[model samples]
Target chain A: MNHLFFQINPLEGFFFGSGKAMVVAGVAIIILIGLGLWLFRMESRLQRLNDALDQRLNDAQNQPS
Target chain B: MIQRSWKIGGLALLGYVLCMIFFVPLGPGLLEFTSTGSAGHVQDQDRKVTVYALTGFGTHWTESPDQLTVVLRHGTQLASLPLIETLDATHVLVGMDLPYTVPSKSWDVLVTHPVDGTLLLENGVFLQDRFIDEQTKWANPEIAEYPAELPFHFPYQPQILETIRNLMLHVPMWFTMFLLMGISFVASIRQLSTAHDLHQDTKAEASVQIGLLFGALGLVTGSLWARYTWGAWWVDDPQLNGALVTVLVYAGYLVLRATIQNIRLRARLSSVYNLFAFVILIILLMVLPRFSESLHPGKGGNPGFNSYDLDSSLRAVFYPAVLGWMMLGTWMYHVRLKASSIERKLRQLQ
Candidate 1:
């Protein structure tokens, strides 16, 4: 097989490599996780409020008066 | 039961997204392939000759330096060269002897790590003089054949490197945002046509609200990616500005909904405004950014320029990421819709 011909240059760029790239990923993941948890808690709270409302409505219907 | 199914599908998608994103292997390839000198220093058979080769970080190099092998390929001819030493995770010293004339000028350096497999550094090193006269071009016999069943991995990119994985998270957020907003646009159209169904308006509101959340995520992640890669948290790029404007337009829709006193008036006005905003959103986010000069790829001269191009191995993970996030966004929109309905019922009781 013919050897592929392409230019290979030496790596150069100071401190602009994998470490900083990972940091960007880390911060983004943190934000997504935090926001997801917040949304989960909010949904749970809303569910509880809706259940309470339903219970109150049921009790009022059962009153003799 | 239908609602329950939606939740199940959404949860399943979320699980799949997490597994694919985290578990894929990087595969055996060159993390970094570079030579210390432009042309390998001239070799004198009588004296010790050494040149440096640097590998990228995260290269699997657990084996001792002796276990590593470096081969030089000139056309079809192959020569196994000795490494003087391993400097660190990134550097190696290669010693070459010109016993035979190198067949071609385009010589390649092949580094075989004990476990990392073979990385071919092509066209970087050269011989000082021509020794061999015959043209002996053939495949290098020394290159190691890797196992066929290597686990799936994100493709290694020259500039992005590890951050290439970020494509799964950052790019998908925009896809999810676009899908959710598209749904919202349809719901607003329904609100206008129907006899002002409160349910449709609520659904539209909920979709935009969740879509905004995803848009916010896209912007933040994109900004972070730019900060590391482009060396800035924010740039005057059209795509970035377009995304911001789309999010703000949706936000304005929410504010408009909040301020109105009359229910019919609010629903009517908001739906009309939503239709206009959705059009502007499409124009700004989709159409305008493609034509302008932007650092983002797939724009102005960079046709599929970035690693996110259609043929990328990232598509395996990225398509699923988009589907999963869109599913999650839909699930959130549904939850918000139900919550709003419940609130309305409770208000009636008051």
Candidate 2:
């Protein structure tokens, strides 16, 4: 884990001094992360809905109505 | 098919914008020009003065020194100066002969290159004058024309530099947020008119959720950009404060909804609150920013990129970016609305 962290040092220097290009990269990354979180939240909601419907279906079948 | 096309189209447009943002180069700009000696000023009696200039981004001064045209501009008059030497691609030594009389003490330096177009340093040199002369003849009079058919490139802004490309990402976030908020506002109005229709309420809630996401992203990105350019993570600008407050107000709408136990009451009360929130949003974002001094472009005393800064090159990618982000936001709202409707139906069934 320590070695893995050190690998980023070279890249960090380039990004930090690259005529403020790092700022653009930062903006793009923030957007990607935000959208990715929303996607995951949507997925989890659908998952919960699926589980609830399946449970209800099981209950209805067992009742023999 | 149409539904799928829009989603795919929006993604493709954003992909195109992403490619252009990183690859498109920035044009050259004059960063600083200073007199080589004697307190960085030229006296009226001084016949010859040497000046050194430092340029930023895409400048090729040494490639063809002869192609470079240096001029001192005072008001409408342009007096051409000879380029004494090219130290490197970014540094140049220029010799200027002091005119006997001039319109004003302040002179703007214009360096026109065949490749870099025309780079200007405002008030590049100052002259020590005993008296002001309104009528003066320029020794070397030449009008510089910017080269035609230059390649597509973002205009080099001194403070912005390469980060100027953030215009594509940062600006579109707010545009997308506005679109979602507008949708939510309309849905809230419909919910109120229909006497608290649950479906309309769901639509309003979903749109606000997505709008808030975009608004949060906008603030974060704007803050990062400000940190790099303005040397601060957060400034007390009206536009920035207004955006933060608007996002918080919508967040309050969510909290208000979550607190209410009764479904009908929640819909009715939140719809009324949404109306007021949108009005506050308009006043803070559009009206107040213009009235007060703001560091953000297009507000207060600052002229926006629209007046001149946003060139054809930027407009090419920027418009597509705004459209793409709007489409993506609408798609997210659609997903949220569908999920919420399903959850509500399941609750009712139980």
Model 2 chain B poorest 10 in a row by lDDT: B38-47
Q: Which stretches of candidate 1 lie over 4 Å from their true place?
A: A1-65, B23-50, B60-90, B94-150, B300-313, B348-350
lDDT of 2 by residue, A20-58 (tens): 654665576567557645765775678688677868868
Please name the candidate that would achieve the greatest DockQ relative to the true structure: 2
Top lDDT prediction, candidate number = 2
Question: How does chain A of candidate 2 score by TM-score against the true chain A?
Answer: 0.56
lDDT of 2 by residue, B1-350 (tens): 79667876887788678778866776777766666663233333345554555443457777777888888788777877666667777777766565566777888888888777788888877777425688776655766677533577788776676678789888899888888889989998899889735999999999999999999999998998898679899999888899999999999999999999999999999999999999999888888877987788886643234557787889999999999889888888888887888788688657
- Cα lDDT of model 1 by residue, B72-186, tens digit: 7666678777665566655566665545555665567667776555666666466655675665554545567443233566655444544565677788788888888889889
What tens-digit string does per-residue lDDT give for candidate 1 at A2-38? 0110113112122222234345445655665565667
Candidate 1, residue B237: Cα displacement in angstroms equals 1.2
